[model samples]
Every structure is written in structure tokens, then in C-alpha cells.
Target: MEGLELTAFQIISAVGTARSCYIEAIQEAKKGNYEAAEQLIKDGDEAFVEGHDAHSGLLQKEAAGEGEHIGLLILHAEDQLMSAEGFKTIALEFIDVYKRFDAEKKEA
Candidate 1:
């Protein structure tokens, strides 16, 4: 827990949490619990923002010529961030589809 490794770990933890939440949200939506799904989505977004902020700090430092050492851990953190972002998109889409199915059921 020092220097760039610390930051990378922070990013990885946050985004990994986000990805878990996003997947859980989809599960909740599948169960027709839209409220829970939405809450999970919110939670995921918060975690994603935290990770994004940590990543941004690194970018800022690099731009200021105080670049940190690049390593596989940092790359893994970036990969997790992107994966979480993609999961968020997928979760939202799944939620919408679930809602539509619920609506149709109610109308029938």
C-alpha cells in the first residue's frame, strides 16, 4: 500500500464493487424487484465514481509530469474500471427490459 500501487488498489476495489452491484441489480430486476434493482444501480454508480476519481487523480499527476510507475496492477485496475462501466450499461438495459415485461403482465 504505497504510491501508485495504493491508488491502483483503491481503483480496483471500488470498480470491482461496482461490477458486483451492477450484476446484483440485474438479478434483482429479473426477480421483478425494480426498487431493489434501482438501489443497487445507485450503489454501483457511487462506487464507479469513486474509482473514476482515483483514476483521474493519476491522470492529473501524469499530466503534471509527476507520473507514477506503470505496472500490471494499474493495468488490471483500468480493466476493472472499464468492465464495471460496461456492466452498468448492461444492468440498465436489463432493468428496462424487466420493467417492460412487468408492465406488459400488468396490462394483460
Candidate 2:
């Protein structure tokens, strides 16, 4: 595969992994494993950032007039990027709600 294709694949892989981490974070919270959930969220953010950086590199290349041709793979990578971002947001909210529930239980 070409360099661009390889880069796109890497971005998709990283972001998809991040997405999974974020989802697992929510699941862990449901199981009352707050610490594990928090750690997963942190891991997810790290993976997402790496993917974002790779994606940004393509954007910079395009801006510099060394445009990378568009393909379905690249579009898919963007989809994964957006999905990861959305998952991260939802995961954070879920964690907060879980924390509140835990607090309530403690008060009881």
C-alpha cells in the first residue's frame, strides 16, 4: 500500500481502539469499577490524540499543496475519528453519573 494509505490505516486503527476503550470505560463504570473506568478513559484519550495527530499530518500536507488523494479509506478514517471523539464525550458523562450514583449509595 502507498504511504497515504498506510497513514490512513494507522489513524483508523488508533481511533478505533480509542473508541473501544471509551466504550469499555462506560461498561466498567456500570460494574462499579470507577478506577478502572477512569484509567480506560485516559487510555482512550491517548489513542485518540495519536490518531488525531496522524490525521492532522494529512491536513497539513494538503495545506502545503502536497495534497493526498481522497479515498474511501481516508473517509473511513475520518468517521472513526469522529466516532472516537463522540464516545469520549459520552464516556465522561457516564463516568460522572456513575460517580453520583456511588455517592448516593454511600450516603444511604
The prediction achieving the highest TM-score against the true structure is 1
Candidate 1 C-alpha lDDT tens digits along 1-108 = 689999999999999999999999999999999999999999999999999999999999999999978999999999999999999999999999999999999999
How do the residues 1-108 of candidate 2 rate in per-residue lDDT, one tens digit apiece?
A: 868899899999999999999999999999999999999999998999999999999999999999867999899999999999999999999999999999999999
lDDT (0 to 1) per candidate: 0.97, 0.94
Q: What's the number of clashes in each of the models?
A: 0, 0
Clashing residue pairs in candidate 1, if any?
none
TM-score per candidate, chains pooled: 0.97, 0.95
The lDDT leader among the candidates is 1
The C-alpha stretches of model 1 lying farther than 4 A from their native spots are: none
* Candidate 2 overall lDDT versus native: 0.94
Model 2 weakest 10-residue run by lDDT: 1-10
